[model samples]
Target: MNSLEHLQEKVNYDKIFDCVQCGYCLPACPTYETMERETHSPRGRINLVKMVAEGKASVEDLRDPIEKCLGCMACTTVCPTNVQYGQILEGAKEVIEEHDVKSMAQKKVEAFLFESFFPSSNWMGTLGNATWLYQKSGIQKFVQTTYLTALAPMRLGRFERVLPDLPSPFERAFRKRRVLPDYKLRTTVAFFTGCVMDGIFFKTNQHTVELLRLAGAEVLLPKEQTCCGALHSHSGKGLSAKELAMTNIEAFDLEDVDYIVNNAGGCGAKMTEYPHLFEQGTEWHERAKEFAAKVRDISEVLVELDGLTFTTPVPRTVTYQPSCHMTNVQRVSEPPRMLLNNIPGLKVKELNRPDFCCGSAGIYNLVNYDESMEILDLKMIDVIERKPNAIITTNPGCLLQMKLGVERHGLEGEMEAMHLVDLLMEAEPAAK
Candidate 1:
């Protein structure tokens, strides 16, 4: 658990009562599927939460099960009662953070990431540049070849392998922030380049912007925008999340843009739920709703744009692993499929569990690597069986997680992982 506070005050007690315990969510939950225990299921987790809220069970009793949840919201897809389990889990996480105590190292790392690193673009740029240097300077090659990287902590060592090559300096990308279409701008759209998205998958974002431009939309990359605070909210730091939401609300001039476009499913989902971050009847709440109203996933925007067609053919048998946030929260399963199917020669195969969580629930894979890998291994069985040439995903975390799965199963020679935006860009005539 992130924190172990009383939890009663931190959560919406009434939401717990909304679950009908119909067992429909059990099969859909990755943890339940992995552990095959009721405690790990959504129904069991809700009941545990209700017990804590009612003071019948201590917070300690519910901590393990609650913390183990991937927060993927797959259960909600099957719920008959329309239970908002994701919100409930977020509330539970908040209470845990408030009450659960942390060790000094934990506290320091959390502070460094949440406070110092994420909120500032400069810090992220510096770190990204350092990572680039580590690779470009040949130090990374030396460490990997000498097996020195293996000496690092397990999670850290694994995370090192998953790190994508950093793009050129942020300044280079920022220089091309505002892009205009060749003929005429049908509409002007703001692109929400997320913190990690901009830092790590820089080329993907660049491709997204170019594709949007090709679709005749003027893309605006807001300079004042910061991290989406999804990680903070998931970790139970609601205040930090709210602060970041307000900062974003202030950053974007909503009236000037037709849509606030996001390529990352997780960031897009969180930004779309900005209204939930604020209180009812508050000014920020109203602002949040207005801001969220304009928010659209890149797929949502791309599929709707007229005259947007891929002239370059991509000849590969591709299967999509829809990011959990995209399918369940953003409610965007079809737009990507519709867009991919538009490609002339591309074969878009459907995975057995397209919406299944890749076990890359934000930082869940890092903190719970063993259990995460367990869930991922299950997903990989289906992925490997399907035997697609490339696996495409909409979010960075899912992209990395899928890559990790390919590496772990020694399927690198047979399959490759790619971001959807990158895939589309590869199928664009200009890219050819």
Candidate 2:
């Protein structure tokens, strides 16, 4: 049986028809906001999906909306009737794949990794350990010398900056089950330690757990969880994404956990789409929805709880890049700002185009480097104008992309980027 047959989700009739064609989602959509094409906007894309389902639209007609969505799901949260557009959009993507097709090579490369790696943390850990070993053994230098990995979509320059070397901050792997010390009440939380955090940003992961523990929650880093498949879905490989969804469904076994805490904004946003990926009558499909219901970004977690108690002073004029996933995709505009304000010396300076997409729309910098860099270049100028000491965002993709933008513009650490969770964890504001 095919995957969609397993998802078995009924088309949400009431919410789907609620669109008034006002085109409000056009400005709200990053890609549509960037391209300004009707086909790319939310309403236009909704119409296109409707036409496709009703047999009035061709597979070729789908190319734009699918490409345009960024898989951001920015439209649904803002829609009055609460149309879960992400589910519909994902269904459309599966349909598109069923009819039209790409090259075997392209399909193979995508399927191999997404199917193989995304659902298993052990396998992912191996991949990370290999990369870490490569760098440690100077094999990365050899690859750079030979211009090998650079030939891939995400080049050495891009990968080098984003891939932080693990500094051996904490040599302890989080127990499959653990308890927190700061228990006002024992709240159970599942964690999505994404690929970067699991391997590269180990400190950030530790910080995330520390902050969560501080906030009174027992955190679980399930060995079964893998990549959130956010990048694959965003990159137009929904079939692979479905496999990942299935993998995580079985792996996580997240029952009894109150929420899946994701420190990274992009991963958190993607985790919320678990229901949309599977369409039919399988456990994985149900599990996907079950898991998604519990997902929360770190900022959202902090905001929902008591505000930050900054232990030390931040003392920096901070420029805020509302990560596309956190702000537009997930429609979480306020939580991050709220977290920042509680810090002792932090100044949350807003960027000129706060709602606009940063070039790093997750592997966007790799596949669509030109446009992505172009977007970053403009964002960099805004940062330069602000002359802030730090730029805080909630996604690894944004932090890396913006950090690169700072570097390309020759600013480097003079202007730094960090995850909002990491910043707040730093500000644990002990009772003085």
Candidate 3:
């Protein structure tokens, strides 16, 4: 079958009609703002999908626009007709991946990342250990001093400079699986420690668990939970994404916990939409709905429990760069701000475009480095205007991207980038 046939067969061609070519999504689209092209905007892309389905354009015509999309879903929020753009986007991605021929090396890399690296806890743990060794064994320093990093790809070198210090192998090995509240337990929650969250930003994950415990909850770190499959779903590996979703559903079980809380906005948004990955009326689809309903962002849970009260003051001015998925997909905008506002002396300055994508839609920055940087530069313009001490965000991708933004704009020493949980931990009293 041809690409058009695959798209017709697998893609949600019916939903393409939902987009009415209304111009509301253009202003909200980061790519449209940056690229100044109709082909890059949400309505423009929707039209392209429609054209492909009707045999007016080949699937190849849709490839660049689809691939270049941050998949931030900002347009969906502003749409008057409530267009399900995400489903359409993911459908196009799957059809493209199905038909496009890839070189051997590219195929191998995709196989490794989608099938092996992301889904395995053991592999993620090993990655953490490897990174720790790179940072701690003087190798990083040698590479930096010897200018070896200069020889590497520009994006890799920039990312390397902002890479967070990983917890030592010993620390990761001895990490706690569960923590009980020092005070009376108000509820029970199973924390979704994400693959990247566990491997790279392990300290942030640690802080999340500690904060949840302090908030009067019993936190369970399920052993069987794997990656949330956001990356797989975004990349068009639908089968792999479904497998990971099922693994996570079985891992959390949802029988004992009042909520399945996650700190990463991208992971939370994806987990909450698990029901979309399966066929309606199927057993897995129903099971996915049950699991998705239990998923909650940590900030939402904290607000629900009235758990934020900082005795100690954090005397710093900060601006929030919200995660796109958290804000747009998860429909969580105010909780992080509410948490930030509760800090004693921390001043919150709003960005001009608070809902703008930081251009770190998962691995978009890595794959589309130049385009990502363009979007980040646009985001940093509003951030620079605030002149805050730190740029705070929820997801790890945004955290790193914001850090890179701070570094790229030569604001490194003047401003820092931090995860919201880490900042909140700073405001907690020392004796707690």
Candidate 4:
């Protein structure tokens, strides 16, 4: 009983009840738009949570609709009444895990892999080095269609959604002069190279560091850090997520860094939630809280830095796609835009329905391909209508999904997709 209670950590319910049902968040709510169901809507989920609190509904009633949610917190951003719905959903997941416990067999398998595979540089490096080989051989399909589905408990999306064609790991890139020199080192930040980002989008991480160094930061790469626990948490293996967080807390605390900045929005969100996974708190709990407090989205850090004067002349309209985790979970629209606008001669045009999810909710694109495609189609149409020269976003998932989507739908080469850091790097320092 104690253990179960510990799992369902206490949440601020009073804040949850403050939602005024204004429906302002509806426009930003992706799941609501996808299903058009009350239960999937933010208001409806809060209602279910209220019922669950009152013992009027079982955890089973809250299972499917809630699980179907992408954990996007766009609803909270638009809510004038100040409902912290994201925190509520994460807390609700804990409660469901404690009481309901459905899908144990599948979750058990995921727990094993996420805990084992993502924690070490060696394991991830080997796997990163193998992705290109797998694609070279005709064995990619069998591994993609059969092995991944069979070995793993769930699907993230279609074949293209989660396919990270990583040639070299981010660790190797960092180890081989992937950074620039910083004179002052105003702040030393540790980058959490998440699984997919570390492997496939290694250049993005490099760009992130370049941007950081340009902003007067000395970036530290903690060689011991793991997956940031987001993969395990999303896969219904909260225990593994907790263990991963503990490992990260220890590794990150090693350096005398000012803050931990993550390019991956999912990792940033998870790092911010580390404290909630604890019971009544000890020294470790305090340590996790301190780390969480220091966690910063890459944009957040870049925007906050002094002398981030941009010299890159975009000279054309650039559409911005905010990741669901960054937009909803982290509530970071202004920082990204602020940084983008800093670039000389750049026009920051908003994507139609900018807050809507791109349907690449972490692994959601891979497992729920049909729904994911539907969402991405909506976004693609919006992007094509704008006719921007480039689409800059933060998350790798968005880059992948948006890239694959535009190509398949024959919008190929019409618009380019890249990370905000990629553009930030183009901003040259004032010439001596």
Assess every candidate by TM-score. 0.94, 0.80, 0.95, 0.82
| lDDT tens readout by residue for model 4, 1-432 | 454334333334566668877778776777788789988888888888777766677777877666767776777777898887866776677667767554454345445555556656567666666766667676777766665644543442233334645554444645632244455556777887777687677767767777787777878888778888776676555787788899999988988777898998778888988987676558878988999989999888876776466665767778998887876666667888887877888888898788788887766665466677888888888988888877888887788887766665776556667778777776664311
lDDT of 2 by residue, 1-432 (tens): 343333223223344577778765666676665667888788888787777555576766876556545665556656666666766665566665666543343355456655666546666666666666777888878877887765764354556744666543125343335656454744678777888567666678778877777776777777667788886775456776677767676767744688888878788778776776765697777778888888888777766766236778777888898876776556678878887888887877888877666777665565556656766787788888888988887777788887787778878768777777677766664421
Task: Sort the predicted structures by TM-score, highest score first.
Answer: 3, 1, 4, 2
TM-score of 1: 0.94
Candidate No. with top TM-score: 3
Model 1, span 241-273: residue lDDT tens: 999999899989643899999989999999999
Model 4 accuracy (lDDT, Cα): 0.73
**Where in model 3 is the C-alpha error above 4 Å?**
1-6, 101-112, 429-432
Error of 4 at 290 (Å): 1.7
Give the Cα lDDT of each candidate: 0.83, 0.69, 0.88, 0.73
TM-score of 3: 0.95
In candidate 2, where is summed lDDT lowest over 10 consecutive residues?
4-13
For candidate 1, give the lDDT of residue 158.
67
- Residue 101, model 4: lDDT of 52
Arranged by lDDT with the best first, the candidates are 3, 1, 4, 2
Residues 173-242 of candidate 3: C-alpha lDDT, one tens digit per residue: 9988888987778899999999988988999999999888888889999989999999988888899899
Best by lDDT: 3
